[model samples]
Target: MEKYIDIIKNSYSGYWRYLKHEIISVNHWDNYFYGLIIISVLVWVLEIIFPWRKDQAIFRKDFWLDTFYMFFNFFLLNLIILIALSNTVAAFFNDILAKIGLSISSFQLFDVDDLPKVLGLFVFFIVSDFVQWNTHRLLHRVPFLWNFHKVHHSVKEMGFAAHLRYHWMEPVVYKSLLYIPIAIIGGFDAQDVAIVHFFNITIGHLNHANLGWDYGILKYVFNNPKMHIWHHAKALPKHVRYGVNFGLTLSIWDYIFKTDYIPHSGKDITLGFEGDENFPKQFLAQELYPLNLNDKKK
Candidate 1:
């Protein structure tokens, strides 16, 4: 019991320390709080300067809502709930592993410790992105998961801040699945791949922004706004029921798996699911809506 109390105390302390470091005394370029702000402002400026949807307002529909979501999912939610829960879960899992005479470092697909730092980052990037890609598909295909993901699809406007406007449960889903392969290739922590993390944040923001840049020939490799807009289209191709363009940071997966779909320019397509009109518009309502989905279905 006291162990759990200590966990909560530590989690809160860590959260406060990070908040102060990120906001009050910003000292690092790579700190997520500052980095998120920098990348978001950068992409938003690009959107304003060269927007694909010229008629769209500078402060598009739900702009403030999405902005709140950005900070909530990135920081505030951790302070409220996730940090304590995650710490408890990790501690429990570690205890179970200890009972079995195994630790996280027990399994290794290969040793990345000796590899060049750049190459190691590359390897982690590839593996983790693939995990996220698969996880993204599951969010669509799984009914229970889709309910939670509906918070994100509720976005009617595309903007840089919309990139992080997802249900708080999403990180739980993503990190849970990403753990297996990452542990298998153990040698570095998330901090060690800060470059990849920031790069993905940039691409994610760019993918959701109201910009049409496709990286020209490199569209085959990285995700771009033109391609990703289709992923959010209100209508899906009849033959494909679940979703399309399941790529998180890379478009290569969609192309390779034949899930890529861009019948034409999707700049003007209506975005959201079939029943998004009934979805909650308020943040707290959206956060709680998924919990009631099964009850509604019954």
Candidate 2:
């Protein structure tokens, strides 16, 4: 027993050393999915007012599986943030700022260590959300991307898993494209980025919750779950039922694009595709099914 224990310890020690030099590390981003879990549940309770479908059911198995993936995506994204492009930009900024002056009396190099990271992440999230909102609308309008995107909108019933119901291509494409610009321009660290992802997942889940309650002015700056819930309504082009809120963080882009969708009006919206029989109910079918959208009007 002692020999085996020592062997295990030795192996772990070597692994730690390898990670220290060859691998980037992640911390301060553990259990990050808690925020998302709570919000999603709340939204579920309120889904009755503007459910994607009148018949949307809450399945126990689907609920847990979606929750599991929320945590999984959080952890996985945090891992990427730590190793790939967290502090490289910060170091670069510090070097440039140092050349100008440490404390030039009028203006210091920076307010604090984490200030730029905070502000930079805020801007990145809002901008990317705007991009996502429009891109989503375009996909629905166009034919090709909508096929895959329909995989997400095809869900007849929504729950916490509804947020994760997106076509797998979305995460790979959006994160890679947006993060690259953010890493280059904002000088974010892996830790800070992870924090943003943690918040984002939480908000996404909260938006998908079936809860009720109007958030008031908070709707202007942030895209609440209630507002986002209407987007996944699976149906399109309702009179006085479209156009109001369109952002996860900031409403600026939605306003600029003239595509901002807000449901501030008191019209009850029927969410989900209008008469969509091909929509899958099983969780595995949601993931395993090809993102291919068939023509000929389902």
Candidate 3:
């Protein structure tokens, strides 16, 4: 009982420290709130002016729930889970590497600062997107993983907030996988990572937004709303595979892998899983939805 009490106390203190150090000290909360406001206003305006589905309401079905998901993920889930997972992965890897007479501290592939900013940015973007692409594919292809991933796909209505409607465990899984590889490559410093992250967030929002725009020939390089909307299609065309268009920012991966599934028109497409009518519609329910062990039996 005393040990358990101590553990709880220590965990609370640690979290408080993290909240102070990582969030407050760095002004992450201010930046995130302001950035979200700016993007939200911009997307809201764009949606009103150039909606893909003219009949789609501004405050469509599940909009509030998705908004909750966005806040939950950005403020609580990501902060707690990502930091914990990052530390755990670092410690675990360090211990294993030490046993083998290797050290991440000594690992350096290139000096990122020495490279031109554009070149460094390009390399980070490509590598990170590749990692995310594979991870997204795995989430859809692996049945057990899809149970959690389905939370994101449960959104029947697409919007900017839909981009953030991911399961809480996803960032931990994706970021931990990304850390080791990026660490080894060594050229990407904090600024380079931040730049890639900014582009990723921007593109991710646009890809899910209801704005009716496909970059035409440039869609081959960058993912567009039209291309990504097909990914959420309730039932894909017969020719396309079960899970297609797993790219995050770049469509080049899908092109290379032959998983690109954009047709001449997406007019008839419907979003979300076919049998997801019973999926939870509230934030708390959705958070707990992934933990229901009975899902494995189905």
* Clash number for each model: 0, 28, 0
Candidate 2 per-residue C-alpha lDDT over 64-126 given as tens digits, one digit per residue, 9 for 90 to 100: 656555554444433433223333433444556688874122242333234565576776666
Cα miss at 202, model 2 (Å)?
2.2
Spell out the clash pairs found in candidate 1. none
Tens-digit lDDT string for candidate 1 (1-298): 7888899899989998888887976666668888888999999999999999999998999999999999989989899878887887778777789999998777777767878888889999999999999999999988889988988898998988899999999998888787768888876855778789899999999999999889999999999999999989999878887989989899999999999998999989999988888888899999999889563373
Give the TM-score of each candidate. 0.95, 0.60, 0.87
In order, what lDDT does every prediction score? Answer: 0.89, 0.53, 0.77
Candidate 3 per-residue lDDT over residues 46-144, each given as its tens digit? 888889888889987778877878777876774555555556566677878999999885676775566788887777777788998998998888777
Superior by TM-score: candidate 1 or candidate 2: 1
Global fold similarity of model 1 (TM-score): 0.95
Best of the two (1, 2) by lDDT = 1
Clashing pairs for predicted structure model 3, backbone only: none
When summed lDDT is taken over every stretch of 10 residues in candidate 2, the lowest stretch is 103-112
